[model samples]
Target: MSDVMDYNSRLSDPASRKFETFSYLPAMDAASIKRQVEYLVKKGWNPAIEHIEPEYLMDSYWYMWKLPMFGETDVDRVLAEAKACHKANPNNHVRLVGYDNFKQSQGAAMVVYRGKTV
Candidate 1:
């Protein structure tokens, strides 16, 4: 048996336009996204929005702003930030990221929020 672990990031067909944690799974809905954020908050993780502009779609690096929603209990507030980021960069690929300071790493939920069409 071949021992190979698929840990490196993956990309689906450009036509599919689906960028999710699991290549085959659909992106999480609003409710699921909220639950994830709450879970991370309860675990003492700080939330932030990151993105790669459409012009930089080929670029793997994501730009995370300095503003992070630390100690935020309201999911709406966090969602608002994500929405605002999407609104500003409507053509970009935005995502929600939670950072766990205690572990010095990111949380499990890395939600991708495809920008709105304005």
Candidate 2:
């Protein structure tokens, strides 16, 4: 149908590009980011930080800031680490990931900081 074609074209437009899971939504604020961290803590998921240059956004692997914070339930600490990563890699896209140890996989991931676009 023409309507469906139009919608698909809009979604594929470069100006409307999306990154990670939360990229489809509006940019999140500090409070909202903290809330997400809180949820990860409450869910007992280990938090980790990763970053990559905007050009490598489509890459499957991102450079991990550090090891995953296993058994870390403190929301503030997780947020602090994410912020530190962003500060160190100002020109890279910083993302937060919640690793589910039991499942041995990532339970959640979202871009917290977007790098400068040329």
Candidate 3:
């Protein structure tokens, strides 16, 4: 039996939200948004056009950014780039961004044993 338990932060509450389209708003511009898209692409993900919830999420984005598991990447650098994009334009067009986290695969069996932690 293994004592260490792995907790994945990826799993979070799923909820649907309502938002307005901030696309044309003067908050974020096209060039800056492109940078955000490029950053996501570099991280092996595509930039999704969604609204921020802001309540249960940081910056109201559900699954806003996905990072690689093993490969070494510059976290701060990428985040800074994204931040620049969001800041370059701040539009308050309400749009709904859905968020749902679940286990994609049942990898193995769970063995429950009556034991005490040492």
Candidate 4:
């Protein structure tokens, strides 16, 4: 169980199209998103650094389009906070990386803000 505790190793355990950033929106439909992530892990919301990435659940939508979540249960501090939020938004246009299906790396995302391209 050592692919960083195996949360599907961050993607691609036969997942044709799974995604993170829940609070519920856009509907990628993982069986109603695994019952809303098992009701946010039974309302405990584990956090070695807090924030389970949902963008805003419903009204203030952000990354609900999918592939923008974040995690770091601490390791290199989530790549130094996704490289300092992608160097404070370097002309954002769809950038979020946390490989596992890509191979092995985990935590942090949100390299999008202005150069716009949802």
Winning candidate number (lDDT)? 2
Which 10-residue window of candidate 4 scores lowest in summed lDDT? 47-56
Candidate with best TM-score: 2
Off by over 4 Å in 1: 1-13, 16-23, 54-60, 115-118
True-vs-predicted CA distance for residue 55, candidate 1, Å: 5.9
- Candidate 3 wrongly placed segments (more than 4 Å): 1-26, 51-118
TM-score of 2: 0.86
Model 4 per-residue lDDT at 53: 31
Model 4 segments more than 4 A misplaced: 1-76, 83-85, 101-118
lDDT (tens digit, per residue) of candidate 1 on 1-118: 9998654433443334435564346667888888887887788888988887544445667888557787777888888888888778777778787888888878854645664322
Task: Count the clashes in each prediction.
Answer: 0, 0, 12, 0
Positional deviation of residue 19's Cα in model 4 after best superposition, in angstroms: 13
User: Which scores better on TM-score, 1 or 2?
Assistant: 2
Better of 3 and 4 by TM-score: 3
TM-score of each: 0.72, 0.86, 0.24, 0.22
Candidate 1 vs. truth: CA RMSD? 4.7
